[model samples]
Target chain A: EAGVAQSPRYKIIEKRQSVAFWCNPISGHATLYWYQQILGQGPKLLIQFQNNGVVDDSQLPKDRFSAERLKGVDSTLKIQPAKLEDSAVYLCASSLEGGESAIYFGEGSWLTVV
Target chain B: AQSVAQPEDQVNVAEGNPLTVKCTYSVSGNPYLFWYVQYPNRGLQFLLKYITGDNLVKGSYGFEAEFNKSQTSFHLKKPSALVSDSALYFCAVRLYTGRRALTFGSGTRLQVQP
Candidate 1:
């Protein structure tokens, strides 16, 4: 089976610019997630989507980051007026709608704000 | 809140020797544990998960984990290490606050010397 797919494997933008990352989850998977992995730290959940509806986004920075899943299949995460601290990898993952199920991740979209 | 911990920042083992990466989790009830590996510049790949019925969960690439409820630990082990086994390993727990989410630990870097 094919795994999750993400675009723009790498991106570099000037500080205070805007950038967007896209994700397409595995087929038939009902749960999707977006995570930010900064260097020297673990992955932190930016948002989660259960069939196009948000499940959790408490850790997300509402002032600069936003995400959406359309039709429960594809997701897009956007960051506006990016900061140098925002330079990290954005990971997209999918699972079969349960906590017990293992989540498979894409290669990740690397972001660098200069 | 449920969480997992990888206390070691890095682990070093010689090739052909046994290896162990420690992980511990904290949660309210029965916990679901997972192990994932991340190569440099790559996303997380699922290695194994412990949901129910089995304390010893085996996963890809000759990796296995033993779940100890008494200790609240799920430690990843390999009988014999290889140079290619070097990577960053993460321990995660499945949580159900409102919806399912996976919370990961800081990660342990495994280095194998041939």
Candidate 2:
């Protein structure tokens, strides 16, 4: 089976610009997640989707960040008016289910805001 | 809510020596614990997980983790360190309440000397 896939391996943009990253989860996986990893910090959950419906987004910076998993297959994370703090790696992951199944991650999209 | 902690910023060990990376977690309910490794400029790769069965869980790359309910910890261990094993390791937790997202620790950088 193919693993999760991501596009645009690296991107550098000025602050206030907008950028988007795409993700394709493994086939038959029902859960998708977006995580932001800042330097020297853990990867933080930005949002979660269960077959196209959002399950969580409490940590997402709604004011500047947005994500959607349409058709329950592929996902896109967007950062508008990107802040300097938004510079980090965006990781996309998917799993068969919640607790017991294995979760797999993509290579991630690296972003830098200048 | 759930959270993870990697107490060590980094761990150093010589090749062929045993190595351990410490992790602890907090949650109101029972947790599903996991360990992941991230190489430079890459996404996280699953190492192992502890759901319910044995206290010791083993996974990819000869890596294993021990789950301790009393200690509220899941520590990643390797029988013999290799230079290729030098990378950042992250601890994560997710609840069984149907939400499939994960909360990750700050990460531990492991440096295996040749």
Candidate 3:
């Protein structure tokens, strides 16, 4: 079975530019998540969606970060007017269920904001 | 509020020796723990999870973690480490109640010397 799929494995943008990352979860997975991993740090939860509805996004930066999973199968995370602190890897993951389930992750989209 | 803590920043072990990476977590109710490994410039790969039923959970790449409820710790362990096992390890936890997203700790770097 194929694992989670992500696109644009690497990205670079200026401080005021915008960037986006896409993710396609595993088949039949019901939970999708977006995480940000700064260098030398662990993955931080940015947003989580169960089906088309958001489950949690408390840690997300509301001002510039936004994510949506319209069809529940694919997701997109966007950062508008990126900052230097936004230079990190954006990871997309999926699980069979919302809670108490093993999650699988994609290769991640690396973003370098200059 | 849920949180995870990885006490060590880096650990060095000779190949074929035992290794351990420590982690602790805090949650209101029951905790769901997880361990993930990440190679350089890559997304996290699920190593193991401890939901219930067992104290010791074995996972991929011959890695195992023991859940100690009394101490609120879940430390990843490998009996015989290999040079390929050098990577970053992260520990995560979630409350058994409302939120389903995980809170990850700062990662620990494992360096296995050959």
Candidate 4:
């Protein structure tokens, strides 16, 4: 089976610019997630979507970051007015409906904000 | 609140030797533990998870994790390490209730020398 897919494996933007990342999850997956992985740290969940409905987004920066899963199959994560701190890899993952299922991730989109 | 901690920043092991990576977690309710591996410039790959049942869970690439409820720890282990096994490992946790997303640890770098 095909794994989760993401676009623009690498991206670079200047501070104050806007950037967007896209994700297409595995077929029949019911849960999608967006995570940010800064250097020297683990992946941090930015948002989660359960069938197009948000399940959790408490750690997301509302002022600069936004995410949406339209039709529950594809997702997009956007960061407006990017800062140097936003330079990190954006990873997208998907899993089956239940919490017991394992999550598979895409290759990720590496963003470097200068 | 749920959180995970990887005590070691890096672990070095010679090829064919046994290796261990330590992890601890904090959660209000029952904890769901997970292990993921990531290569350079890549997203995380699911290694295994411990939701319930047996405390010892075997996962991909001959890796296993032992879950200790008393200590609130889940340490990843491998009997014989290979150079290809070198990567970044992350431990994650989530409560059984409330949130559906995971909180990841700071990640441990495994360096297997050939």
Best by DockQ: 2
Which of candidates 1 and 2 is the stronger one according to lDDT? 1
lDDT of 1 by residue, B1-114 (tens): 899989999999999999999999999877888999999999999999998887999999999999999999999999999999999999999753346589999999999998
Residue B95 of candidate 4: its Cα lDDT?
78
What's model 4's TM-score? 0.97
Model 3, residue pairs in steric clash: none
Report the lDDT of model 4 for residue B88: 96
Q: What TM-score does candidate 3 get on C-alpha atoms?
A: 0.96
Per-residue accuracy of model 2 over A45-90 as CA lDDT, tens digit each: 8998999999889999999999998799999999999999898999
The CAPRI-style docking tier of model 4 reads medium
Q: After best superposition, candidate 1 residue B39: deviation in angstroms?
A: 0.7
lDDT of 3 by residue, A27-70 (tens): 99999999998888888889999999998898899899999999
Q: Quick one: ranking by TM-score, best first?
A: 1, 2, 4, 3
Off by over 4 Å in 4: none
lDDT tens digits, residue span B1-114, model 2 = 688889999999999999999999999898989899999988899988999989999899999999999999999998999999999999999886667578899999999999
lDDT tens digits, residues B32-76, model 4? Answer: 899999998788999999999999999999999999999999999
Pairs with backbone N, CA or C atoms under 3 Å apart (clashes), candidate 1: none
- Give me the runs in candidate 1 sitting further than 4 Å from their true place: B96-98
DockQ of all predictions against the true structure, Cα-based: 0.74, 0.80, 0.74, 0.75
lDDT for residue A22 in candidate 2, whole number 0-100: 98
lDDT (Cα, tens digit) per residue for candidate 1, span A43-82: 9999999999998999999999999997889999999989
Q: Per-candidate TM vs. native? A: 0.98, 0.97, 0.96, 0.97
